[model samples]
Target: MERRKVDVAVIGTGTAGMVAYKAARKHTDNLVVIEGERYGTTCARVGCMPSKLLIAAAEVAHQVAGADMFGIHAEHVSIDGKAVMARVRRERDRFVGGVLETVDGFPAEHRLQGMARFIDDHRLMVDEKLEVEAGRIVIATGSRPNVPDFLQVAGDRLLVNDSVFELENLPDSVAVFGPGIIGLELGQALSRLGVRVRMFGVSGNLGGIRDDAIRQYALETFNQEFPLDPSAQVNRVERTDKGVRVTFTDKPKGKSPSEVSEDFDYLLAATGRRANVDHLDIQNTGIELDERGTPIFDHYTLRCSKDHIFIAGDANKDVPLLHEATDEGRIAGDNAGRYPDIRSGMRRAPLSVVFTDPQIAVMGLTLDQVKERCKGYYGVGEVSFEDQGRSRVIGKNRGLLKVYGERGSGLFLGAEMFGPAAEHIGHLLAWAAQKHMTVTEMLDMPFYHPMIEEGVRTALRDLNYKLNIDPQMIDRALECGPGA
Candidate 1:
């Protein structure tokens, strides 16, 4: 058995783990990154980059199919799923190859195709033979799709995000169970690709999002764009001779509980995801895990109870966005390299974005969080995608940007936007919220005229109106008025 020693041992080469490894390399030459699988993490192989590539391809196919609507005559427009899959694979390989090339030249050793298990507090058994001892360890073992015990996933018919991408043939119809970011993005993309897709979720709409106006807009846009029935609940999934059948029960309030079934060539089970911590064996190390089996880290420093072991990314549980994971990883890497008393300088609020057609982006607190924090707190905001001239020109008029602020202090609590450029602007609002910027500060900034940013100005104007400020104070000279 080979024995190795390092200053830091990073598990899982995903976005978060990779960032930690890169950061730690600068501080110490004794670093090792262990990946269990042959390929890179979800984002590189299945989750973000590949999924977005497929969505872009679908969008192009949609536009080409509708060329006749704009007086450009075209007939028998079709898509080759195989070619699209090939391109997706090629792009994925290119990305993974680039990362691997960079890591190869680094001073730290790369342990590809190896699993790490804790042999002791400071010792880890890699690939069942090699013994590695490190002073500090960082866990970034991403996440996996959460398939319920009741649902059985057979080879061809049932699929998760990972297996769905490797499909040789596209399903003519699909029943997606869950109204999450994954479900919405993949469901909408498949629908646009001519798949008869129906999404079923126990919740009324996208869960974890507090903005009702934006939720309503998403529901409306999904129904208008695809075959969506938000009022249905999936009872169970079963495989049959014809295909896979999804049994659904109708919502209450005089709605019949009839068992509605749909047969599809394939079914995508994107209900949700759970942290990939099953193999870590934290019980032996005296580390704590939450109810959902995720590591419990200090909210401020991201350190586990064991001072030398830090956890970040999906393994930490609460914030699961890619950007959040990267940020948390950086904090853990920086803190792990220093002494115990040195604080991890990372306390910024996270921003989340759902990559659907219109793209839903949210940051900081929602109105519910504000109300819970303060009993007599009042929220003021605006909701409108139609008010922006950019939305009209782009021909996508579906979404609303609402900014919530504390009434007395005029401090921005949070912001939610759903529109063509909502994702980009949502980050801007998140920065403002983190910096404690006021509405007046946002209004004073120079914005390009006739752009989607006009929606931000409109939202601030509406917030000012709700605050009962004099309209004259926000005239063209102040650039805080509705059209200013």
Candidate 2:
């Protein structure tokens, strides 16, 4: 067997692994990055970039379909499914190629191609062909779509986000399971692109929002475009000659639930993702593990039980976002390269965004989290986009934005939003949360007239008043005009 030694070794060369390798290289020349699969980030390859490309197409289709509301008539708005899929694939390949180029630029000697499994705390075997012994190891193996065993009934008719982008043409209908981030984004996109989509979730969780009002608003808004059961009672899934068939109970509001069965070209499972650590043989490492067999590690340091072992990115499952993964990878790599001198890395305020239309976003502490931490020592402020100026002007006014504040300090704890331009608004709220800005302080920030951000200001104003810091407005002085 071939044997090698290194100062530090990083497993999986995705986003986290690449960042870890670069950070470790700064500390030692004897470091190598291992990749069992093809090079490229999940985002560029399948997750964020490619999904957004599909969403962009869907957005265009939706805009043309809705042009009549603006006194403009659009004729023959035919959607070419084949053409849409073609562009999605072509642009997806371009993104993946860019990531591949970056991987190619890495020093050849520092890259290893093989599946790595732990033999001991500081040793690993790569596909039984090469053995590696390192002073420190970092696991950044990323994650894959988690498919439930019951869905196996769909057999060849099953599809995941990874395989969806590979389609030659859009299907006539799709049954999307799990109304989480992936499900909502893909389900809505496909529906807007003229595909019949029925979405189901195990529980009533829409876009991962914690605030009840916002979640309800999102549920109502999405249901208007397509059938969405955030909480579904699915009976069975079977593969038919043509495709997959699903049986479930349809529970319409204020009516008795009825059992129904439907067939679709495919059953898309977007339930969630599982970290790619199970195959790593982590048991051999003698590290403390959680019930899920994932390593229990410090969030700030990204260190496993062993001083020389570290975990980061999706492998750690702390925060699965791309930016969070990048940050964790750097921390793990820096700590792994400089073992025995572990230091806590800076972690940013938590932020998450769902790219569905009228995008959904949650930043900093969620309402549930705040309640658990502060024990009802907080207040909530809300604004609905139904009457917001710019939103009404664009006919994109749907959903709500709720901001939270501490009762005593009037601190802007966090926010959950489902409204137009939420992606941009989420970033602004995240920045404010990170800066420890207060509710009144956020309101003090200039909000230009007739902008969507004005909605945010309105929420903060309500929060400021709720926090008992600002008087309840008797006069509508801030109102620039109707809808403004």
Itemize residue pairs with steric clashes in candidate 1.
none
TM-score of each model, in listed order: 0.90, 0.96
Give a tens-digit lDDT track for model 1, residues 1-484. 9998888888878878888877677687777888876546677777888789889888888778767655787877688877877888889778778767755665434554588888877888888888889988999888889887656643467778888888765678887877788888898888887788888776676834677767877777777776566556677678888678877775444775677767777778787888878887776687877777676789767888888898888877768877778888888877776636447555675578888878888876777776765455546677688656878666666688888765545556677777777678888888877766667777788888788888888888788566533334424224431111
lDDT of 1 at 227: 59
Quote the lDDT for 67 in model 2.
Answer: 94
For model 1 the local lDDT of residue 380 reads 64
Which regions of candidate 2 are displaced past 4 Å?
Answer: 469-484
What is the RMSD of candidate 1? Answer: 4.7
Superposed on all Cα atoms, the candidates' RMSDs to the truth, in angstroms, are 4.7, 5.3
> Candidate 2 residues 1-484, lDDT tens each?
9999999999999889999999999899998999998888999988999899999999999999999999999996899999999999899889999989988998899999999999999899999999999999999999999999989788878999989999999999999999999999999999999999999999788888887777888888899999999889999999999998899999988999999999999999999999999999998987999988899999999998887899999998788999999999999999988888999998998889999998999998888877876678789999999999999988988879998877766777788999899889999998988877777767778999889899998898888888854332212212221111
The alpha-carbon root-mean-square deviation between model 2 and the true structure, to one decimal in Å, is: 5.3
